[model samples]
Every structure is written in structure tokens, then in C-alpha cells.
Target: MVSETVSVSVPGNVDLAGDLEVPPSSRGVVLFAHGSGSSRHSPRNRAVAEALRRNGWGTLLMDLLTEDEERSDALSGQFRFDIELLGERTAIAVDWLAKHPSTSGLPVHVFGASTGAAAALVAAAERPDRVVSVVSRGGRPDLAGGAVGRVRVPVLLLVGGRDEHVLDLNRKAAEELPETHRVQVVPGASHLFEEPGALEQVAAAARDWFLQSAGSGPG
Candidate 1:
């Protein structure tokens, strides 16, 4: 596999840092949108990315916010909840992926965590033809507002069984989605899926969903 630290340019001359990994003859690529207050360096997301790479999928873990924006949000906690801005950035990342030489021909999938899931849904709605599938991990898909119903591709919502509130929200969001959507609960897991084998299960489910929906299997 070849892994590189890359920069993605968005509107307003802003560049977001990303870690991109592409394995030999990868069947597809998955872009990761991290939760609020998290970045491309998130351990859980990285673990999931590694698992996907092992399954012959490439991964791009990128920060939605620039360093300055992140610092400002740290002080004011404002930008993290700006779902519109986040969604736009996610869409920009998708555009970048479409132009990237290594990943352009492959199908695109998105894996979003927490609030990032909302942004991912909005991006999918905007680029219905480009995005093949989406997976949310303990996400606040309800926060996506009306955009949730606009997503045309298959969606998989993974939540922790013990996380009652998020589970309810996932159910409500799933209702707004099309019949291709599904909600899977991780037994004995919490919001972060920090329990033993919980994150692995999330990765496995995400991998299967992407492979099936995108028609990309092991290389």
C-alpha cells in the first residue's frame, strides 16, 4: 500500500490536511468524515480505515476544518455544528477525489462519525451520481435536517445498542431515508463504540455495505 500526507484544496483557498492510503489494485476508495472536535488523526477512524485497506479498499482521512478554523472552534465551539459548511467541505473533498488520478476510476464511499455523518449525508445528496454508498457510525443523522431524505444512495447507520438516545435518532433518520437505508445496532456498545470488538464490528459492517453497494470486492 502507498500512504501519503496530502492536501485538499477547497473553496476560499482553504486547504485541508488528509492522509490517503491506496493499496495495490484497490477496488474502491472510502473517504472519512470525522466527528466534531476530531480530525484526520482520529484513532477509531484510522483503525477502520486500516481494516478497509486490508479488504482492498483505499481510504482518505481528511480534516474538514482548517487549522485556524479548528482553533477558533476550540475557543467558541461554533464551526463544529455548522453542518452546511461541513457538508460543503465534504463535497469539495469528493470533488478532489474524483479528480485524483489514483482514485478517480474507482467507486466512492463515505464513512462518517458523529456530527460528520450529517455532513456526509448532505454531500451525498449534493453529489448523488458520484457517491455510491454512505455509512454512519454513532452519527447524528437527525441533525442533517431535510438533507437526510435527499440522499439517493444506499446508507448504513450503525449505532450502539446501549446508546438509547442515538439509537432513537438513527431510527427517526432512517425513516426519512429511502428503502435502501438500514440501521444496525452494535450490541453492548456505547456512543464511541470503545467496547471490545465494537469498532471492529462497525468496520466490518461498513466494509460489507460499501462492497455490496459499490460492486467492489476484494482485489
Candidate 2:
């Protein structure tokens, strides 16, 4: 069950756009922090979200950028690289989910792709008490700057084999993270991992990691 029509509006602030799906036996909720020029409508992220839902996990796919911000960033490409802005917006989404009636009180996980991965780490670092775990798919975790060291939650950074550059970056980022986290390199996959069964592996790795870290201390 994918709730394509479902979304969230924060009111006073520009309402964040998203697709929410809650499974009957959802163990926790995973929120998506899309990378540059992307939104909840991203087919790749949506595919992984749906896979998560099938495993009895709830999912929140949200666009961290506002319409105006998104438009400006598309042209300037500045906002996307500004880790602080993306991190703040990602944190807002986490806070909203934690307080919402449908998803309130549930443990939270942030799934970040590409640049979004770094944003997720920043959000997790800022709100360790609320966010339980993190999963980065072909993420640029290093872009989060020094925040990676302060992240208390267990982080799983997934990288593609063919994407050597990202894989190297993720490896380097893992060194900065505390010993509680890990970096998983998937073979035969690249940045987007559009090859057959590659994204599914990313989703599965993320699912297992999130499930393991759900209630664990500092995970």
C-alpha cells in the first residue's frame, strides 16, 4: 500500500510535500531526504520507500526544499550544496513526524540519497534524541562536513561498486563517524544503481540496518 495521495502540510511554514505510507505492522517510519533538485516524486526513492512498506515499515518521502527554494536552487545549484539549509529542513521534517498523530512516538530513520545523505547525517546529529538510525544510498556523507563525527545514531552508508568516487567518499566519511556506524559497499552498482536488482539491494540493506537500530541505544 503506497499512499501516493497522502501528504503533509506544516501550516504557517510552507507545507512540505511528501508521500506517506504506513503499514499495519510498521515497526518504524523512514523519512526520505532527497538530493539535489529532487522531491518525493523521485521514482528511485519511491521504489525503495515502497519496498520498505512491504516489509511492514512505514515511509515518509518528502521534499526538503520549498517551491521557491527548489526553483532557485535549480538555477543556482547553491542551496543543494549548502549542507546547513538541507539539514535544517530535514530536521524540521523529523520533528513534524515525531509530533504528528499518525506517526507520533514512532522511532525515526532518515534515508538520504546523493547529497541528501549528508543532510540526513546532519539532521541525525542535531536530533539524536528523536532520530534512531540513518541510511545513505549512494550518499555523499562527507558533504555533511564535521557533523558526521557527532552523530550518535548508528549510520549505514551504502555505496555502489561502479561509483568509485562515491564509494571512496563514503569510506572516508565512515572513518569520521563513530565506531557505532558502518559502510556497506554493494558490488556491480553505480551512483543511481539503476542496474537490475541494485536498488533493491540498497533498500534491503537499509531495511535491515534500520530494523536493527530501531530501539538500540545510540543506533
Best by TM-score: 1
- In terms of lDDT, the poorest run of 10 residues in model 1 is 210-219
The regions of model 2 sitting more than 4 angstroms off are 1-12, 217-219
Encode model 1's per-residue lDDT on 1-219: one tens digit a residue: 778899998889898999999999997899999989999999999999999999999999999999899999999999989999999999889888899988888788989999999999999999887888899999999988999988889999999999999999999999999748899999999999999999999999999999789762211
Clashing pairs in 1: none
Taking all chains together, each candidate's TM-score versus the true structure is 0.96, 0.93
lDDT (Cα, tens digit) per residue for candidate 2, span 139-158? 99989998999998888989
| Model 1 regions lying over 4 Å from their true place | 216-219
Q: In lDDT terms, how accurate is model 2?
A: 0.86
In model 2, how large is the Cα lDDT of residue 200? 91
Clash number for every model? 0, 0
